[model samples]
Target chain A: MLGDQIRTRRELLKDADRRYSLRQVAGRVGIEPAYLSKIERNEVPPPGEETIKKISRDLELDPDVMLAMAGKISSDLQEIIRKRPLLFSKMLRALKEAPDHAILEVVREVTDGDW
Target chain B: MIQLKGTNLVLRFPQVHPKAKASIEFMRTLRVPNDGNTYPLPAGLGSFELEHIEDHKAQLPEDWLKRGGVMLPMFQSEAMWISFNGTYPIALKVATGKINAITGELWTNELTDEPQNYVVLSEQPWLDGYAVEQGTVRQFVATPLGSGESAEEQITGEAAFGGIQIQAFPMKREVYKELFESPKLTDEVQQYLEIPAFLRRCSEPAMGLVPGGSIAQEIHKDEYGLDAWDLSAGSRCFIHTVNSEAWSELTDLPMPHKPISARDYKSANIPWFKYYAQDKKALPGSAILQKLKSKKEKPATKREDAEIGQNMSDLPVVKLRRSDVVTEGVF
Candidate 1:
């Protein structure tokens, strides 16, 4: 589920003294307690960029991870694609078509080479 | 509820750190036009309000807290300059949870109008430098961050996204109070700078290319057997927050509904009068600051480097790829 991993990761980060309550965390994060509960239960789609930012902060989860989990493409990556569409497109195509073993080999070969 | 019902409605505007020594001299020190009769401070360093907001609590709105409390309007256009050298861009705690750095305007989206602890979430990459049509001969701007493209059309979301995210903090009131009450300016600006260490700490749980440039990892990814360049400016150069005090006051407001539009920015207006729905009875007619005028230091007769360009003392100077680029138009 979209939120299963966030739930697991958030729990891992929480300490006993700082145990986060759904409502407390939700209030700080600007979400409904029920909404955060739904998020933890994997009962809803991941939130938007702004909400994901709040949730990640409230849960002590990495915001980028939460954003990624929520499937939000950050502005930085979007700009990279916009600037070098040809290179990014080719790189994506190569990665998509390459087998794991071949990709590993290419990775090995590139690593073995010096800058 | 106006919890401050009987309390004084004291509103403060940002002023330069009275004690911090300026690295620059002979430049425009005060943002507001001064008579140039005294100490030459750095120009456009931070914001200042001649009039502090002071009124009875009864004047405030009933839903003041709900509407995000009294707001201190920010002038994002007033850029401040700092001189420092770091391979990675440093983040300035312009406000709580909010940071102005070499890269971008970092913030959280809590949407509170209360005196929220500036929960600086992340300096998401907003802008980057493309190999400009002019190629490697890119010159720097008076301000380093914000808007790299000179042309207006290229300034869209697609062209502007920098791709990094940061977690925020709902810091205790004391934390924000410490920041607000602290000296507003410092020469060692890096002390107030916070690195988005979260970006460095988390690995991808799934597939994604590392958005390249001087992001947390991309700076060092090269020496660690990945792709990177010597883009980190060698030394003695930095990305400084220009109009920093506005950013400092921004922490007290609710999150903006949209990205700050420079076209719509009202720089000359006072914060209490503009953003907040309530009105002040009259202007303080805040007299021209006599304190900044007290010094007898005469304007340099043979003024040193009176030119408008930067006065880079003994510090080493170099340029590298910005950690995150904000297009302030071609320099």
Candidate 2:
């Protein structure tokens, strides 16, 4: 039964990889295609928070898109954004427009919020 | 299009950058005055280190930035070669910073990511040329907002950037050819493989140098080197992967809780690839002895094939059975 579950999980993840070609994913997410392929093969795990947000937006995936996988669990930082869409939205806006310091401000806002 | 022909690889870039033009001059510095020996770094030509910086709102302008942004430093360690297929668009970003106990380096520096669209080689008429191909970039144009009205929506369009062919590997042209026997692959193929390798290598935890599991398959003595495999196998096997954007998502997770950095890492399994301290799977006694001993179970000889095609039986797969448990204080 455990083996069966593992097979199912692999199939599901494979579906995600096929759903988005490396080029298409890079276009939507802003990461390069070669790096994307690395993730699919599990050579490396998913990238950090900002990269994840970009991937989520590019793939139009749920905020917990990475939660579907194994290895390292989602970071508390990601959990904060997952639980609070407003904060995530504000963070994205800042990344797009604010200066480098603004990223810290977004981090502060997320950390200060009620969990 | 400028074609740089080597024994193994052929590279063609549609655009060229001004820095590449400068690199030609830079290459001269690397070349020996009379003996023609390329000196090592510092004395060879110039050298710089790469650093990674993270800033949420940092905007990159057209001009080059000495340091800034979500930078991924890359080096052309050893000898490098470049050429243009048509026109070339070249852009280079260099990073530098001091080492830190927390993350090794603060990685606080990053240059802009704009490609140099043109080059003017005054001395050498052959080298002096215009870029033939355009680069890929998306631009957003916003209309002005009215005094008492909402702002106008922005419009995006595709514009032509310069294209230039470039490659940097540990081996030099002649030496690389001698080492590999066959020529190196075209820049197009190398670029396709190298970029991903760079991101994964630079970002992932440092462990080993090998990119993936070096699985050895038995080589058969047939009329054609790899003909039998193709005849038996209909479709070639290929390992598909997730797109870069989805992969980058893993980086956002908290330090300890984040997914594994899929880039290369040392492994306990497959010591032949040389990732672990404990070695297993010892090499079999060589072939000469096999003739004396009664012929029975012979180990497979893995032959390297240059053909770029599909073989269902020989699909490449990276088996990452280990879990990444980030201990406290490692980050």
Candidate 3:
């Protein structure tokens, strides 16, 4: 899914401007052109978080969305979860199927330290 | 081609190199008094809101739909400047209604070095107006089409198009790698490459940029040479300027507030700007652009003096010099 998403967006950008070639994007992302091609074709697994961020930056896509699509979490986020494993695990499970606004409300309450 | 990323237009070159990307913003600034006196660069208040033409195809004229780009609202006589951000080296050609802002020649698909039809980034940070003279430019003031104030009306004798046109070409990939990737790259150039990621109304008459008051600004010479740009891989965008009232009617968006008057800004002790790069050379004034009469030379049709009060005397100015190191005094 991540590969499809990236490939589709890249193609759209390329359609508008012919310069967004796979090789060029790979070069900018510091990845091998062959490896990027394989990833786009879904023959290889998505790259690590750093590479994903680089690709997202080059493509002007949201890094968070790309990370979510990749089924990976950023190291900084992992650290945050690690610090409060018990509470975060419980919160994440409770909020798994929650609507975005409801989850936002909880985040707002916690951020405001109103609870 | 230009893609609307929020209000900024992102010009991408996928065929050239992924790093060969640049974003442009039209900044709202004070409309300096065009009372036959040149002034310093004004502060950028904010960006103009932009909307894609495809989204509002039903309401737009057929010609606008055919042009197929983005549109922004602008008030008559309002001043604005272009802000450029590039991840890598890019050559940008800017024109007001098919009239080249640099050479004052008619728009052509090709980039030429004889008169230097384009400005190179990230060396050149911003463009304020027509390149009338060396190290000086007349500010871009919006005027309605057919008013005979716009450069288009003056040169072409017809207001066929009443908006800005932009084309961007990135440096050849090999050339960029050889120049920038090498250890010979200067700190100043490197610093300029690392620029961080960073409107209008509807009226029926349509608006085009006219040379307003003169300002001390330079369109820097292309150090990379004309051959360095990958002219084959270039994209252009047509920016439609709609009047504020019509913009509101078409988009249902609130009109932007009037810009800060020059008098108020001056009274507040806000400093105007003067920028100088010690290493780079400024291009000479265009022979054709210099020959055309500025908006000040003609009779004023719009009441601009009332909006931008005429008290422009003794405004404080701040000078910005590049690549200067301040030595710390011994404590």
Candidate 4:
């Protein structure tokens, strides 16, 4: 599914007339054509955090979305969550219970204006 | 110790020689002048068109000719601050016609690029300058070389030629375009990201002030500090660049690898007259200058933090230095 998302986004970038090329994207990711082709075909189970981050940057996709598709979490956020499990659990529960718009607001606040 | 294979951008002047010249001065920025105005290009200081014999192109020394570059005609006392047409770095080979007895070179307002190392004359202080946000518009006043007090400091033995060859590469574009309020980074990266935004706003191709997509960056030298080249204070000159024989006794840097390209002489990319248009980059930008992308060039009082080891996170102003401090002569 993550592979599908990447392919879909790649196509979208092309359709929109943006400068997106498989080679250019792969070059930015520092990978070979065969490997990227395999990734898009879902033959590989997705890569590690670093590769995923590179993919996210080249594809202009969300890092968290890419990580989730690969069944992983950001080491930075994970470290914080692991350090204070109870607080994080409570915050997660509150986030899950919030409305969609409220959750977006929470993300913006959490990212300190970055999101 | 160096070899430059190519240039990033070229500045080609109008095919027809414009005989007009202008003499604008940088009347005091700090300590405020008696005429209480902070901004604007002061009274009596306006762009003028003068009549003079014009060389179609610069006659670079024999060394630079092989590398090839564009040229523009310049007149004495005429000064103007160049702006970056866009957000990229560049190196330039700026020169005027050679003189019979004296040779002239480009001057700068940014202090850290070892200004004294290139100073062929003294008392030709950067006629005047002012800080514009995180960037500056240094007064690049034209003077006939050797007209001012000349120093026998011997920075280079390659025939004290005139005109300037400087580069203006800062950090990579990704780093420069980041918002100023972004997170703090390493000292080196911070310094690399210290270009002022206004410096990139001289003219727009759409506006028709400059030609095409090209934006001009400062291509001169420090506004002050001609004292660092004092041989009496034990200033080291790399013989590899000077002359194998004269610099032979002073071996500070490694020997040059091969023939010196035009870009090699312009190694001072530090906010000097180097810039980017649509497709150009300052190959090896002053270690390179600001044009990166902040809004203001700081004042002298605030630039203390812009020094080595100190995190220049927040600075109000930046001023040109008169002597070597943080870099210890980084020429």
Fnat scores for every prediction: 0.00, 0.00, 0.00, 0.00
Better of 2 and 4 by TM-score: 4
Q: Is 1 or 3 the stronger prediction by TM-score? A: 3
Distance from true location, Cα of B73 in model 3, Å: 0.3
Q: For candidate 4, what is the DockQ-based docking class?
A: incorrect
Candidate 4, residues B101-123: lDDT per residue as tens digits? 01122333232333222211111
Best candidate, TM-score: 3
Q: What 10-residue stretch in candidate 1 chain A is worst by lDDT?
A: A106-115
Q: How would the docking of model 1 be graded?
A: incorrect
Please write out the lDDT profile of model 3 over residues B268-289, one tens digit for every residue.
6555667777788999978888
Best by the lDDT measure: 3
Q: Which runs in model 2 stand beyond 4 Å of their true positions?
A: A1-115, B1-43, B48-57, B61-331
The number of residue pairs in model 4 that clash at the backbone is 43
Candidate order, lDDT descending? 3, 4, 1, 2
lDDT of 3 by residue, A3-88 (tens): 88889989999998876889888889999989988888889888999999999999999998899988898898899999999999
Categorize the docking of model 3. Answer: incorrect
DockQ of 3: 0.02
TM-score of each: 0.24, 0.15, 0.68, 0.25
Give the runs in model 4 whose Cα sits over 4 Å from its true position: A15-19, A104-115, B1-331
Q: Write the per-residue lDDT of candidate 2 for residues B1-331, one digit (tens) a residue.
A: 1111211112222132221221221110111011112111111122111112222214322211222212211111111111112111222211111111011112122211112111211111111111111210011001111111100100111111101112211112233233223556444323212211111011221110000111121111111112111111111100111112222342342221121111111111111110111212212221221111111111220111111111212322222111212222111
